[model samples]
Target: MKQITILVPDGQSTLSSVACIVGAYEVLMSANAYWKDVGRDEPFNIILAGVSKKAAFDNGLLTVKTQANIADISQTHLIIIPSLIRDFQEATKGNKLLRDWIAQQYQNGAELASMCTGTFMLASAGLLDGKNCATHWSAADTFRNLFPKVKLQPEKLITDENGIYTNGGGYSFLNLMIYLVEKYYDRQTAIYCSKIFQIEIDRQSQSAFTIFTGQKLHGDEMVQQAQAYIESQLHEKISVEDLSARFAVGRRNFDRRFIKATGNTPLEYTQRVKIESAKKALETTRKNINEVMYEVGYADIKAFREVFRKITGMSPLEYRAKYNKEAIV
Candidate 1:
């Protein structure tokens, strides 16, 4: 039988972390039971392993008893790292032993998966270097800053490269779990599990759910001014040349500084800001698509629809139907 080990990391558990650990354990166990019901022997031996025998959470209000210690588990078919709650740097530092063990296990031919912010642990273990990874969209900036070598795809619901798997923010890890089931078992079993869990399967993108609050934390006063100007003038057609001239910087230098600070060119940033505003208006108002488009300063309907779909993974009408209840009527 193949062994699946879920690491119970030592830390203060938030709701997301606790849910991921428990949810993963339950889902895999359900799959194993289903496998047995179908006249196959229990194909997986699921184990919850940790650096210690017990990991406390929520200030000792809850304690998880791990089934095996990492040191005792010489080989496993797969390892699932749960979502983390602490600061990424501190969490990585405190879990050095677990990180090293994860790297070693991967070297021993075990597949690795990280749930949400658990990508941090895998990146720290050096397993994700040069690999494509998906994590919570809110952590994209920090993850990029910390692990510049890893390709971060925050818009994706799941990423699978080589033996590593990662999923986007919150509860979306359920989709990754289903994907793994399909990979290890069969399509029928994965579909059955999805039905049981009521999770939508084959979800390819998380773009529709992302809220693109501009990345303004980088300490560039000039870029900050440019960002502010772009946001303030969303109702007007703004160009990079106009912005550069207004800020008293050359166009090439301004573009470079904006990309370095926000990870987007000035034009890309402008599009995102405009589309974000359109998304909000679609979600909250009874206005028609054209009115929303004009409100965001786009006169061309085709151009507006294209940009909206490009950023949101859905057309404006579809987005409204999904998000705005009144619009449905």
Candidate 2:
């Protein structure tokens, strides 16, 4: 029999877009059912561990009950930390009781796991030092700034360091679960579960695609609209006023609210979108420097080059020239 425990924070937001408010738990449960259906001969048990009932449901983010305290974290093969608090202050100011439980479990040989922003909780517990880890890429800078001891591999779908396993953001939790099944049972079992869940089974590896972070804003319709606008106009020169009008909010209000909801200002978020877009162009097309820049909405080559260098540590030409696989092959 294999037992797993999930640690959900108290007062956590139940909003589907907030940290820890995701559908990953449902996905994992479905995978477990498939595993059992395929006669994988393993008893998979999941326990929802939390602090207090009020803490667990303070924000309606979690629909589960608070379990017996951290002392109940006994004999589990895997302990999962799902999405964590986004604010660094909140993450660092962790629950002393929960942190101790995580540390004790890991020291006693429990395989630790994290999904999306959940890596922050693991890092806060000092579990990721000197280990390669992945998180939602949007928090790449913040994570690096806060946890300098941890090695940040921003491009991975999942990273296995020591006995701990962590996946990047989005549905990558499924990727981790599938990987676990294959490792513990066999490839056949994993593939059978994949088909049962109707997931694409032809993936050679999840790493081929960028790991998506699962951070989302709940009730911030303005942020959502601004995000949509940013995506559609990645090639346009967008200002705060443009974003404000798109969301129909005043500029000042939009700026403040966007930052509060998304942890990034409109300009900062737009740069990230551009950099990501530039990365795609570099990987999939043979477009030249100017063409790629223009495609991602940089009319001024010098400024675009500077921004790319600052964000990615490489100029457009340099990044494309250096990492293009075909060029190397």
Candidate 3:
């Protein structure tokens, strides 16, 4: 059986904390289910080992552990950290013993993994240097501010180099687990687990920003309706006059309220929304660049390309290629 160990830390995020514990089970159980259906041996013997009993700090019913000594961690193929405290103080302050243990483990050649803020722990352990890692967007600034030595990508759901694996925010622990299942088993088995978990496996190439947030162009209900109407009518020419008329507001009032709510003018918001849509289509679909441009209501391919590169820092083709190479599967 493959030994998988998850280091539960103190003050872990509630979502990530639950994911690390429950998510690990979902991965192992799903893998076992798949194996039995296909007549293969179960491949995982997972453990939720605390670095120490006192290594953990309890918040209400939530208990976060400090790092444990490597000798207690046992022979494990993988070490997972779901999430860590909000600040580095929680990591470094409450857990000196835990930090030392993590350092020793990395030197011993174990595959290190993290989800969300847990990347902070791995970074603190010094395993993230020279490796690309991801974390929650909210924590993106903090991670960068704390660990300048590590390369942090805020947009990716997961990143892997050599044996170190890190993921951005959300239920990506499930994605990471699916990745592990496939690595040990096969694509078929991974697909089976994904179905069992009701996950969107095809969303492998999807980015952190697009997957988490949606196009909400307007903040107020009235402006939202107008913006929704505008998005639906993207193929047709739209104008501020049309928006004012449709929303039953004066042109000046509409413009001011729209900007106040969305931080952008109506036309600007429309372009941004379209560009976002185009980006999603480019990354997730097999459609050609021209097709994506048209799909997002851009009749001018050159203008779309320029705007896309400016907004997303990459052209449609480059975005697609980058994510296509990333294994969402």
Candidates arranged by lDDT, highest first: 1, 2, 3
The 10-residue segment with the lowest total lDDT in model 1 = 10-19
Model 3 has an lDDT value of: 0.69
Best-matching candidate per TM-score: 1
Task: Write candidate 3's Cα lDDT for 215-319 as tens digits.
Answer: 353347998787778778755657789789988999999999886665467887777677767666766667788887777777888888887776566777777
What is the alpha-carbon lDDT of model 1 when measured against the actual structure? Answer: 0.90
Candidate 1 lDDT over 187-235, as tens digits, reads 8889999999998989988899999988877889999999999999999
How many pairs of residues collide in each model? 0, 9, 7
**All candidates: CA RMSD (Å):** 1.4, 11.5, 11.5
Against the true structure, whose lDDT is highest? Answer: 1
lDDT of each structure? 0.90, 0.69, 0.69
The TM-score, computed over Cα atoms with residue i paired to residue i, of candidate 3 is: 0.62
Model 1, residue 295: what's the lDDT? 86
Q: Write the per-residue lDDT of candidate 2 for residues 1-329, one digit (tens) a residue.
A: 67777776664333422334334445456656766777665456766676765354435544666555666557777777766656755754665566678888889888888877778878888999999998877677678767778987776667887888887766666667677667655677678767766655433233334423322534577687778778788788889887788667898998898776655678877887887788788877887788889988888999988887766666777777767867435
